[model samples]
Target: MSAAAAVLREEIGGQPAVWRALVARGAQVAEVAAALDALDPPLVRIAAHGTSDHAGIYATYLLRALRGWTVVRDSMSMPLYYGSPAARPGELAVGISQSGETPDVVAWLERAGREGATTLAITNGEGSSLARIADHVLAIGAGAERSIAATKTYTGTLAAIALLAGQLAGRGPQLADALVATADAADALLDGLDAAVAPVAAALARIDRMYLVARGIELATANEVALKLTEVCYLGAKAMSATAMAHGPVAALDADVPLWAIAAPDATLPAVAEAVRRARAAGAPVIASGPAAAALDGAAFALPVPVVPAEPLLSPLLSVLPGQAFAWALAGAKGIDAGAPRHLRKVTSAA
Candidate 1:
């Protein structure tokens, strides 16, 4: 393998260890959760960008479903450009950044802190600016990520969000165990990537664009995976919730444009399956991934992921692995450096 692909693979291979470390350091999350519980915020406002924004989306669904907190994905523009506070006094404001140095995110959290909201920073950077600015911090423990594509940090952020949400919801122990199990599942998936993801990557290497569809919490997976493909493989990958796809985007599907469907065995499976049916009927190749992917009829590729048992919300922790691996493998197949994409930097600074 080229050095570029090797760098990306090494980081991806380290996710299991990152998650295990996060679980081992449960006290950090507990402290943040305790602070949150004491504040008893009426709502949550999350500030993030790019991949971190996708993690925020995952946290939005998890926090609302698990703890009944109304969560909002705050567009930093509201505060940075318009001088409006993203959070009210006594509300919870979260800033998510892999580097913990995103200018807009830092500015938003600063505004929240000034507004008397409790600020929390979820990031891999423990002593970074975002961590220092927040009232509390939960480090993802991804450990010195070198690849610009952000494989481990993304998963690490999701794991951190799960731990925090689980703690607030009073299911910390159970969720921690499930997360450790997810780490093991991720290890096994990495061990078998050649068998599972190589063929799919080879088949998709020639395609210029694709669609990723999912619903509920897994919609975050679709969006993140689409971003990965766009960044690494340089594809025009669009992501949409299944309901949104059915509305009008279904018309754009055809044989040349493939569709990747993430259908975990949860409340959204029926609608996701229906979306798969529509994609197939449109003659688009359907690549399915999730715990219940095998059950999707007529899919061109079915990548069945490990089920997290009773914790369906934790499925994204496992479901997103194949998409990550596919991006790396497809980049290799297309002779592109997965670690170094054009016109991008590790830390993006936008106002």
Candidate 2:
């Protein structure tokens, strides 16, 4: 195997170990929780780009669903380039960066701090640029994500966000326990990948474009998974919420355009099931994952995840594992290197 391909395979299977490592750093997680609780902000605003932005989206679902906080996933361009308005006093602004040196993210967090909002940084880098400015920082703790296409760091962000949300829900211990189980579930998912995911990967290898629809918190997973498809496999992929697909996006479905859906066992499952049923009826082959894997009945493919069901917010960590494997497998099927895709870098900073 090529070195790049080997690295991608190793990292894809290495996610479980990364999650366990983050849980081992209980003290650091507690410090982050203390800072968030102390702020007690009425609204949470976040700035990030790419995969980090998807991590913030998962956190947004948790804060809104579990704590009833108004969460905004900011585009960062407004404050960084457009001179947007300042944040209000009762607001908490968060900046997420794997490298912690993205100029736009740093600029946005600095701007929010100056506007009187408490700032927090979630990153993998220790004492990096974003960490220096923020009042509090939570390390993603994935440890040395060397590949251009991220696997462990993305799951690390999900786990870290789950830890924070669990603290807010007054179940820190329980959530930590759940995260340990999640890591085990991730291993089980990885163990079955070579056999269970090969056909699914073969099916997707020839496809040139696809759509991924995920409902509720799983929308976060859909976005990240879609990004992987494009980043490594060069599949023209678009991601949207289940509701958006039902409302109007469904018209685009056809036999030539497949839809990959995350049908997790959440309250949104009923809605997602209906959407998938309708899309399949409209001739769009659908691939589904999670406990509601049945939602993809008669789909071209279904990759079941071995997940220990937790709160809806925490399910993304498990569901995303299969997506990562599928991307790597698809890359292998197409004879391309997964670790280093064309025109991509491990740390991309436009500013």
Candidate 3:
């Protein structure tokens, strides 16, 4: 094993013991809808655990776009110390906790319920405090998320949210097929990870910073990867919109910087491609991960995967893998402990 891999192995075995249950639970999108059905009207205001808020934000955006419902995306800040007091009454506050028992999340929802908001907990823990107090519960089934950085659980939440949105939109059958197919695609993508990891990590190691750029849903995945880079590898990486990168972030680019462009099969791919070109002109090394595997000039690494049809809303889930693998491999290369980040506790009690 590489030094980074040894660190990972020592910190977190190859698989989190939680994954078995999470995978099985991720298979329970049907149950998630049933729980949603039980609590109708006023919609869900989603809050996800800290460091994992991007998934919840993307999921909330997808829900609002698909169902025309009001969706509030709350951040889980200092899980035991900070809480949102602006939540309105009668709304279903959905808390997404991979650990189920994060003190702030559990306490917030418990308080939300007491204040007349129906609490629905989406978590891996069936017996967790949030689950117990929730008026309704939609378990994430992401199993045990052992790595201090979440991977499978984030994907599982995307899948669950997609299913929930489809059900609310009355497109259950189509969504069900899409969910199964997405899991298969994720599996296929995971199979190719070994080949993709080395070059991406090597390219990353050569540079001091990376700009993860993409459009629409993929932008959120970019942010997630950026977060992982900062948290796990302590790297200077930023995730930004393709358009925003041009307006300002692009100005900071230089030859040694690496830009990781996330390309989607959607209509926005052209804009994403052009952004990569602009970044390269600034002398930054570029890498693109997408369906076409279109070898742009200086594009040192490409992940080979088919462009399967996906809901525009769910595209982030597919695009997330390459970045996730990139961050994990980068963590290993730098000898950072993936299971535990420096000066960080799993849950926060300090404000």
| Predictions in order: lDDT | 0.89, 0.83, 0.68
The better candidate by lDDT, 2 or 3, is: 2
Give one digit per residue, the lDDT tens place, for model 2 in 1-351. 688888888888998787788788877888887877878898899988889999988988888776678899976777667877547776899999998988889888888999899998999987789999998898987888888998888888888888887877778888888889888877877888878778888876778788898788888889999999999999998999877887777888888778888987757888778778888888988888865787556767888776476644567888887788888888888988887899988875655
**Model 3, range 94-193, lDDT digits (tens) per residue?**
8877667777677777777777777778776778777898886767665555456666667666666776778777776676666666666666677777
Give each model's clash number: 0, 0, 8
Best by TM-score: 1
Q: Candidate 2: what lDDT?
A: 0.83
TM-score of each: 0.97, 0.95, 0.82
Per-residue lDDT tens digits of candidate 1, residues 1-351? 778678898888788899999999999899889989888888899989889999999999999988999999977898789877677998999999999999888989988999999999998889988989999998988888888898899999999999998999999999999999888888998899757889998887799899999988998899999999999999999999987888889999999899999988868899999999999999999999988898789999988788888577888988888899899989989989998998988875553
- Locate the minimum summed-lDDT window of 10 residues in model 1: 342-351
RMSD in Å for model 2: 1.6
Candidate achieving the largest lDDT: 1
